[model samples]
Target: MNDKQVMVKMVFDRWYALLKNCDTLLNSLTDEQLLREIAPGKNRGIYLLGHLIAVHDDMLPILGLGDKQHAELFEMFLKSPDSKSTEGIPSVGELRSHWSKQNVMLKEKFDGLTADDWFGKHNSVSAEDFIKEPHRNKLNIILTRTTHLAYHHGQLMLIKQ
Candidate 1:
């Protein structure tokens, strides 16, 4: 095991551990609880769940893995804040299913990447730009998204009140 491989492993470990922690927190909430806002009128627990799904779902194409599965979620969860009326949002059941499937698929793709592959530019970057900005790699996505999950995990704790 070389230094690069060890560093990559450490990052992946943090990503996986945080993801699992967030999943456990999300699972503890009931469907009714999910519909309730994390704060008085802020984003709902379920909205945050779907937002996470949509963001993770996007990583597939961004990382050159494959097309994302839940484009519809973007309108409700990504494009805008949680609405007072539940017009275009997916059901809590459907969001949970999508979240599970999206994570499993991403994990498979993530597992297959070699340490060298992790340092390669993602699909969204140009080869010229990548040459100048080598840090815009696929592994960076995992690091950033892990932090994102952690941020939401703290917000989710507010839902219990």
Candidate 2:
């Protein structure tokens, strides 16, 4: 392979690593702890888990993997009055299953893309409202999203620590 192939492989690898780290972090918390609100004003693990899933679910349409049927599910999360309401928060097992399924779906989407597809322009209206970036070459966007997730995950972990 050439430089481009190498770069894409690296991006995919890094994405996998990030996702694994996210899963590990989430798995570390007990069900009760996952539901506990660590800080008075902070979101609990359940809220963060739901938010992460919602974000990924929102990305599905932008990635062209499916229709926008789940868009409202994520929208509800972003527009919800309180993150701690537990109205839509899944159980720990349910969250774990959801995470696994979404992870697989995202990986499939990434793997199915051609070199040009990664750099092509795609419009994504997820929790962030509006986002447009090169779909074929999305290393920067992946890094940015991963960083955001890590930051929030760190905050959640610190609260428990």
Cand. 2 TM to true fold = 0.79
Tens digits of per-residue lDDT, candidate 1, 1-161, equal: 98779989999999889888888987898888888888887998889999999899889899998887888877778889788556667888888888888788888998999999999999888999999999998889888998999999999888877
Error of 1 at 42 (Å): 0.8
User: Which predicted model would earn the best lDDT?
Assistant: 1
Where is the poorest 10-residue window by lDDT in model 2?
127-136
| Model 1 quality (TM-score) | 0.95
Model 1: pairs clashing at backbone N, Cα or C within 3 Å = none
User: Compared with the true structure, what per-residue lDDT tens digits does model 2 show for residues 13-103?
Assistant: 8777878877787777787887877677777777777677777776666666686434545654555634676675557677768878878
Pairs that collide in candidate 2 are 117-136, 118-135, 118-136, 118-137, 119-136, 119-137, 120-136
